[model samples]
Target chain A: MENKENILEVRNLSINFKTYAGTVQAIRDISFDLKKGETLAIVGESGSGKSVTTRSIMGLNATNADVVDGSIEFDGQDILQLDEKELSKLRGSKIAEIFQDPMTSLDPTMKIGRQVAEPLMIHQGLSKEKAMAKALEMLKLVGITNAEERINDYPYQFSGGMRQRIVIAIALVNYPEILIADEPTTALDVTIQAKILELMKELQTKINTSIIFITHDLGVVAGMADRVAVMYAGKIVEYGTVDEIFYNPKHPYTWGLLGSMPTLDTNEDVLPSIPGTPPDLLDPPAGDAFAARNKYALKIDTIEQPPFFKVSDTHYAATWLLDDRAPKVTPPADIVKRQEHFNKTKQG
Target chain B: MLDKDAPKILEVKNLKQYFNVGRKDEVRAVDDITFNVHEGETFGLVGESGSGKTTTGRAISHLYEPTGGEIIFEGKDVSKLKTKKDEKEFRSDIQTIFQDPYASLNPRMKVKDIIAEGIDINNLAKDKADRDAQVEELLETVGLNKEHANRYPHEFSGGQRQRIGIARALAVKPKFIIADEPISALDVSIQAQVVNLLKDLQKKRKLTYLFIAHDLSMVKYISDRIGVMHYGRMLEIADADELYAHPLHDYTRSLLSAVPVPDPEFERQREIVDYDASVESDGKQRKLVEIAPNHYVRAADDEIQMYKDRLNS
Candidate 1:
């Protein structure tokens, strides 16, 4: 794991969006690195800055968005400092993205073959005939049946699941080094979502592309991600390997999220949900954004923001509870059960 | 969770809802499905998109006229109501909470007016002051403050808008509520909040709910008895725990297997059970048969014994 190279490194990235109401600080200063050929999932509720962080990597932020600070380094280049032309060249061919809704992602009027081929023509300068042939092959790679015949069909001809497959094909057609999928399968049903997630894993091994998977579903994250970053109120509260985040979570927000979701073995009548909504980002909170909802919040949590407390070489969490002086508090019963179950599995 | 002696609150017998009848693109959204909801119980209907669960909820709420069959509510046939007075009374007895809070709410109306629409129509209030007071109380009932009544729907968050929708539904004092994917549009943190609110309200008001959703885990948690729907048919129905523990139908098993649990170790080892749709279109006659006590599975005469055998093993 130490020998693996970091394909993309984001450092102290902060973004603010100017609106009529005020300036909304969408992404607070945060940093993380993506290892080559690994799937790093950013899990958070809506407006938690997971999408903003990923969108900035593609230089796809809105015109009103202001990158206040930080650097996005990829391939010996600072992506945040790249010119429009340079960024355009880097996108699609080097760092392609798949959006949430497949229905709106692809051009409805254009044929599926043309949509997939356009990126290749633009990024790689492939001939029309050559790009179309490659597009057909990519379609087949994505598990579309009768790819030759279906390549000529429009986006509307395919089902929701099939349309997402085409979206994946378009993103991976150029064999990009990084594939940023923003809630790729949220719109699809569970059965279709399962197939798509499986297809993604299979394709990742074949192409060896580092994926930045963004979604709010913890279940999907558990199945797909090698590493997990849990975000709340525009800041990453905790991050670690999937095992550490699921089995030994240190942050109160993470505990609330895990306990809120009922599993098959869950027998409790009431869920241990986090109380209150997220803080308004326009004003931004004074201290820790999660302190208002966290039951284990310390007095310092209300006045001073806690820095990252290292739990291990790979695991880090921002919580006052990790301080030596803070009293030890038990996590929810469900999370303790999860830890017990994980240990049992590890031993067996 | 459900009492065996509880009286039936709503019953649909071979209900059918079809669009574009006799056309090339005719869609049998809800076809020949039968189920009954007991009084004061959450009956969850779950299926994938385009599986007629939403259509079933709409048909029960009278959002669409059923193409065929009877919807018996509290011993009265809903389709047989002839008088305007009877229809108006029926309208107030059952309410629907739509899936999307953003679209279900009218942006122009104030929160108070949105909730009071039902009160005004039912003549439940005495005067304007009484109406305002009732609206304020309803808002507080759903975990909102009275100050929110003056604001428009656009000003509130997704969770708040959903709370307003619940308040409006409860404003009519309906005996039964049809919540069609109520919490699917909400965030995970907020989803639990809304589900808890619904459960609390049910205990307080003794309201029966026809909760329809595609999320299998959530449906299982909230529902006392669960019904699994497929293309246009009810594939299985049983006690919530029974259905999860011993799913008899192939489609039910596939749906259950496909649900990604939050446990990483369990998820990695989970195998997705694929259902072959060709088996359903094989032209064999099928019906919902009880294989175990109170456990129903859709099967043909030849497949019934196979299902029972599988259950025993």
Candidate 2:
């Protein structure tokens, strides 16, 4: 909660894509903070701007995308104003990024060792020999046993999970203060996903680095994140500590997401979907972005978008239902069931 | 892996699908693994990407002929069948639902034609109208309307396209089908919808399925019996709930422990740990052993020793 604890902060961040058809508002006044040595996971369905929000921080937004407003302040300095060259130094040095697909992120033509060494070569001014040695060390750090031999192998030679570990190694080789992982485990199988998460968690502890884990899987969020920000239609629908976001959920959209999780407690017969697709960012609907889909949408919810109301010290959600004036509504019955199931599971 | 009593709709025993790579070592993709799908049962085959779950599914469907083992579908030895007539008969009874719904469906073909292709090939329908009616019925069965039959494969969401693929599979009226992680590529919410649709269709059509996936939770939900595979071998097999409740195998135990529960209370409580170190401890080895009725597991030496001692005593 302390100002000094905030490693990265986004204030009223708004991003738009200049498409051939029309300007698409991808991120609408989204704001959140990542504390030092902590992970802030922005969770959402596809096109929820979860990836876009983090992508903006690394200055990795699409070519057509424009940062119309807001500032991404990192280490008390606004990174948005930094030039491409300055930002280039900051990227993969002070701030590193791990993409969704490791296969694509890694260069197939080059040796995995050389690909990892390139960042070290450019930023740290290390010799190829030193960079290669450091790269092998990093690969070992990521739990790749035969790092020395495997370093010579191409991305195609490695498995999906192994490829992801290689990507993690590349990201962490720079020893960045902030490592932004965008759906790092989505491409992996569950066991492999678990391994990747574990490696990241272990490495996070070892380095004491801040991680901005951007993922749609709330299940993964529970295991990985210290803080969770639920994004919907270019907005931070809910933001809180992992416990608050998952256990004592305030937002209906959050509840819907939790309910949709195919856990043991979820009833086999009735599977709940969010009812419809995410709103078109090209022309987003006025009021709460989730209003149309929300079954418990209030009269005001359809007319006015709600500001984030405080639930706990570190918890807040942008839903009128959280408002005192907005009638007191309980979360979905299934979420309560999940809580009970969780309680029983933990108790035993 | 083949059960004795039950009528095996599809028996894929010791199915080995080896892909010869460049030089050095031949990739043992689908090693000696055997399983049988009883009539009206969903036999779940689950593993990681390189674990050969997809290969096993493909081998069962005869999309790729197994280099070893027998694929006895409804009574015929699919792998041994050299004659075209026998292969055609086998293909008619066995169908496949691929992972990528978008890529798997023919872009140029209309939905009607896509579904009706199998029927036309097999001559299941008497005439064009009969085939149209059959296609429409198949469409309705998979949650798509008959009117959408004229639409192309491109004119649908990922979920709808999967449904069309399901429709295409169901068109041949195959008693058995292999759904190769059909829901993995879909959205989380959309995944359940498709999973439930598969379950519902299985019940209504009295269809047997070889549902292959890496998701334990979804696999537990839809499968009658779940097979946990690692590397190229099935580590455990048990009734859906039983497998989750009492995972006997070391690999299965580790796998279940690895699955991140969605609830923060549970998720926060359980920190996932690296497994390779544990698996390699003391240079121990484990073998797949049946411990309970209709339940088999790969146990460590210590566990196996205890079992052996108990059995001898």
Candidate 3:
């Protein structure tokens, strides 16, 4: 239904983690697609399988995590069946990754130039000198002003924001087709967080690379996402365009997420959090896991998982409330009022 | 807006907190930053990472010695206090709530003992029964059950752990507090819960807070008057409403512009501040002056000249 430019497609993906406690189902029957040059933001609270889903794409999930079902189709090949040798060849060259902490992702002993050139050397078969020059080019591409000089410095010499930029440069060094960023800016300050998000959007345009952006911040989702998939208890309960998720949210969990966001406009109101915590993934419920905490949960929601009902052409939600047989329901009046209030004040 | 009728609880003038790195040059973390906490009001100190917001908070609570300036608390000069007894008395009056609840709270101890540690040391509570009663009252005030005092901080959620931190601060019965980025470490959903709890507690206790954080949206949600700092200097300090509605300084405006509006439609169309354009000429050399009521800004000489020259052009 998009612009005939699907780069990556995930179908009914299920993954389980072999922890000492038990087999933890981190991802459950989740499916979504990333279009060329578009951002598909996977927004969820911590431990909601947002990162696990992306990590699975890169085959970077811990050894304990087993991909139980479904397939990830990338450039016409199923990624689930790839061996480490194959995955290694594909990773950093085709599916580069930028993780949460830039410090850990970067090597302490190595120079920044050598680290960025690692992918270029391995993937492009370029010489050390050529790769180093290309690494410095990538550094400048991500807006490092004095990239040529700073290439010799270690990762410790850079600030948090600068380190994150270096990570981005490394992620894009091989000119990857799909860039997977796992909470890349969560550790940064808000101002720097904004700059990085803006840089990502700018970089995506220049390279025409599809991005799988994973984060818990709705603020960042608002700034850069083209499509949003709301995850809850190892499942994507809502998948839609940014407008549908923000303006006409169907899932009750999405409502809680939207309501929890604190804005300058929400000055005097006592910010509401979702009543209870997310359901335990170790022993997840059969039906909608969100029913336990959802104030607007229907009986059907508790009995059986709702099908992906169409709200609009490109928007769908796993909620029974969107059913034609169901009675009409509206979001909390406070939510409606807050949306209007935010709209007026949010614009300059 | 506050009990302007009441006396000032904490007043800082020309406060300076300088740190010497390996070399001779000093990192002026808090350089000549001035602000005051009314008898009861949440005065927010906001900035990005290196803006010295936490340093200012630490200096205000006397955790760090100021290189120069005066800290007058309740009509006494805190900077001039030399004796341990006087400093200990000052410490009792102004407590601190650190950012990481896990790092701040002693993991080995139970919540009750942790809360009781300060009061017991200072002899704020006379008897064992009095100490237990005070702990219970503080626990209940922070919306925790009386039994929660027996449990360790690890047992509670992030928001609950922060509440325990709050209860600990309240145990000593401090009038003025420096809550340094209390909720920045919590989850996004739980951040609102903690912010609301802090606001409710502020109303109940009439506590004056020097709330320090990196998030402007959150700072706006909590602060009465906001002081913005950049590169160790107070860039701007104005009423929260006025600062957000009309940020005067280019740097302040740029900071405000960076705060992502949490609406999908608005975010796409919204104009983000370009880091290159805003601070092109000014690195660390920006002259700051108060242009209006409680609003100060820093800009390079060329930028200042350009502003003047443009107005005349």
Q: Say which candidate scores most in lDDT.
A: 1
lDDT of 1 by residue, A1-348 (tens): 545899999999999999999999999999999999999999999999998999899998999999999999999999999989999999999999999999999999999999999999998889999999999999999999999888899998999999999999999999999999999998999999999999999999999999999998889999999999999999999999999999999999999999888777676778678899999999877789999998898889989889999999999999989989999888888888878887897899
Off by over 4 Å in 2: A1-4, A127-133, A146-157, A265-267, A325-330, A338-348, B1-6, B19-24, B80-89, B124-134, B271-289, B298-313
Ten-residue region with minimum lDDT total, candidate 1 chain B: B57-66
User: DockQ: which candidate is best?
Assistant: 1
Score every model by TM-score. Answer: 0.99, 0.89, 0.91
lDDT of 2: 0.82
Best by TM-score: 1
Which tens-of-lDDT digit does each residue in B1-313 have in candidate 2? 2233668777667778888845478888876777767888888887777888887877777778678888887677876788887788778778899899989988999999999998888889999899889998888888889999999988788888999999999888788888988987877767867887887787788888888887777777777898877777777778888777776655676778878778666775775444562553455566557777777766775786664454344
What DockQ score does model 3 reach against the true complex?
0.60
Per residue, candidate 3 scores C-alpha lDDT tens digits across A171-241 of: 99887999998889988877788888888988898888889899887888888788899998899999888
TM-score of the A-chain for all models: 0.98, 0.95, 0.95
Docking class of 2: medium
Between candidates 1 and 2, which one is better according to TM-score?
1
Which residue pairs show collisions in model 1? Answer: none
Summarize candidate 3's per-residue lDDT along B1-313 as a digit string, tens digits.
4564667788888888888944589687877777777788778887778889888777777777688898888888877788989888888889998899889889999999999999888988989899989999998888788999888888887778888999888887788888998987787777877787787877877888888887778888788888888777777777888789877666677788888777876786778665444453345565565556555556566556554443334
* Tens digits of lDDT, candidate 1, B1-313: 5778899999999999999999999999999999999999999999999999988988887778889998999898888889998888889989998889999999999999999999998899999999999999999999999999999999999999999999999998999999999998999999999999999999999999999998888998999999999999999999999999999999999999999888788888989999998999999999999999989999999999999998998
